[model samples]
Target: MDRISQLPDELLLRILSLLPTSKDVVDTMVLSKRWKFLWMFVPRLLYDDSHQDIDYGRFSRFVDRSLILYKAPALETLHFKLGKICGAGDLHVWIRAADKFSVRELIIEIDSSSRASPAILPRSLYTESSMLVTLKLNNAILLDVSSSVSFPSLKTLRLVSVTYPGNEFVNSLLSNCHALQDLVVDQCPDDNVTILTVKVASLKSLALHTSDDRVEDFAHGFMIDAPNLECFHLRDGTGGFCVIENDMPNIVDAYIDVSYALPRTILSCITSVQHLDLCLLTTEVFFLLQLRVVVLTIAYENISVSVRLLILQDAYPVSSIFPCLVRLKICTCETEWLNLLMRVLKDSHKLQALELGRHHNRGGNVYWSEPSSVPECVSGNLETLEWLDYEGREEEKQVASYFLRFGSCLKKVTIKPESTSYDRDKLVMIKELSFLPRSSPACQISFD
Candidate 1:
């Protein structure tokens, strides 16, 4: 017999609770008679049916038996994923059973191959369960709650593909969750929620992602007023106007990813952020649209209205606007990114590190534009420069040469050439770049 089997039942049950799934915990029952009923007392239960080999009939039978036979006084966590086979009514019964046991953390993932209808969440979830500290629902429906919603101890809430009656229900649900700290809403596809206002005073971290496939004609957006928020992430799918009423003076970091144009209001909200990341679709890369001041025209019959726009139309004088910015990273393959780089270097006087690369997307070429004057950072605070998937094009070489020549306080410049380039070509580019005059005698140029 193994020494582990000799441990007390309490210790054995604690050991089993750390496993990834309750199914794994049950499998240990066959180890010995002492282990047979130990899993029944485990505080955490997790069921996942995403695997292709999962036997639906057997899994259902197992869940039904587990809930009935479970003897734990209180469940620390209860998680289950009901795929296409399980009905919403059955899931409601499961939630009620878990509620009887006083579960503290509950995660239900409803993934149905059928898009015809989404599973409806039980009403008891909002009105009766006060012990819940964490709640996550995916691909589920939340019916309108006319009663006062309650979850006194709840701190984290994540809803993905969850449909509610309308935006008011969502607002009411969040407003009542007084102790919430982390909230995530991802890709909810109901037309009833055209405009959403999230006003959580206690929220500290928030993430919101919308679908990129939204129709252009739809009126959809969000308004936020979280005063004490520290971190925020927004992955916008299209052009939607987002308004932030309260200034987030306590914000430390922010990540913004958009498929199309970002609203003007967003940039102003993150002025105090020390770290910032901007990700966008290749078609929406700023400099590609910056090559010329293009006049976008709309015509009806013989009449045309011409609208002149800048690359950063609503956001100009980037440095003065972001006075607190310290570190900046740009992930783009657009050749015109250098133009934006110059503007940032001129404005962000406190910037310490700069990173440039193709982020999550393939690389192409870097376009070179003559800078009218040397950027402030090139002569002062800039320390490190790193570039990934560098193609060593002529424009890239010129830009590298300019930075190497003018960066008086620069310490390191690291470049990684794209895999398509020949080893000999990389060496030639390295030697040529290495010979350029460096303003900072200690500045080192390394190539990969």
Candidate 2:
């Protein structure tokens, strides 16, 4: 008589719930007579191709039998990570079975290596799953769904590498999610989705990323009109035009990474953002904005802001463009980047902290120019400055000397030399920077 087998039915079921897959739960039946039927009552099912030796047909049959025999009143979660089964079956049947059980959370992940056709989702998945709170689909085809599609309780949805029917279906799908708060759409490229428009009002957070190296070009672009959204993120490598039609007053932060720079239409809507991270293919992208960002901020209250910019065009923002920008991190190697840097230092009136670094593999000799005048930040609010991958180049030394000479309120200057830099060169750089006259007597300079 095993004492563990004598545990209460509720306690034994709880123990089985911790197992990773439904197969493990079923295997527990052999441990004792009491556990023979306890797994059938578990409220969760996780089926995956974890056991490699098992043939696809046998696994498919097991799943079919298990779902039919499941006596649970409600399935709180149903997850499937499936591999190709050579005409083994369609996923629509399994999804329908889960729908009958009122599954609250459903996750389906498909193996792309399988040569079989992508899973064609059932219409019931979009129109009937009112009880679902979270739904995530990966590598699946979402066909042209009904206009009446709805998910009354869904709060979070993630679709990655999913093929959509068209913009209308995408719009219809989003509009029907009455309670959707968080959404992520990545690499969902389709011929009919040239103008990907998302107009969800109830959405609080959203992330959109176009696929890398898309074979086809997007003729129109991407459009979004989420008024109540608080956070927005976008990574588009398609080089398509992106437009935001609504004023996102509730948005507190935004992160953008694109193969091309964003046009003014997209930037203007997110000017209300307090924190921003922009990664662009070229610095000329900023100049492409129709309205200067400096002019847009005048209407808002004087606010402090932080920005991280990864630009490749060897250019920087124009003077007065970032009047309220207080903190900035820039990664660039264009020898001419300092000109833009000087303009930023001269224009950002409230600027306090700055960080500079080389984050790319671009290699070439760099040139620096001696500016005619000191930037306003050097005389007033500028405080902390850090530089990474310092190589003791002449241009780098000149810039460092300029900062050490004029930064009045500066509290610290940290330099992290590149791994390829020689110790003798680093010593020389430290000695050269030490002699420069600092406007702030308390400022400390350290090298790493």
Off by over 4 Å in 1: 7-11, 52-57, 112-117, 188-192, 259-262, 280-313, 317-319, 333-336, 359-367, 419-428
Model 1 residue 383 CA deviation (Å) reads: 2.3
lDDT of 2 by residue, 263-310 (tens): 344445665554455444444434543123333323333221211122
Candidate 2 overall lDDT versus native: 0.71
Model 1 per-residue lDDT tens digits across residues 1-448:
5898888877877889889887898898898888888888998899877566787778877888888999988999999876655665667777887778889899998775644566788787886578889999988888876687778989999988888888788888889889999999886556367667789999999898886555542135677889888888887754443567788887878887654343345666667777777654443443333332232212212111212232335433333466777788776654456655676678777787888876556554566767788877667888888887787778888888888888888899999888888999989888888898888999998887
What's each prediction's TM-score? Answer: 0.83, 0.74
Question: Against the true structure, whose lDDT is highest?
Answer: 1
Task: Give the Å shift of residue 87 in candidate 1.
Answer: 1.5
Candidate 1, poorest ten consecutive residues by summed lDDT? 297-306
Which candidate has the highest TM-score of all? 1
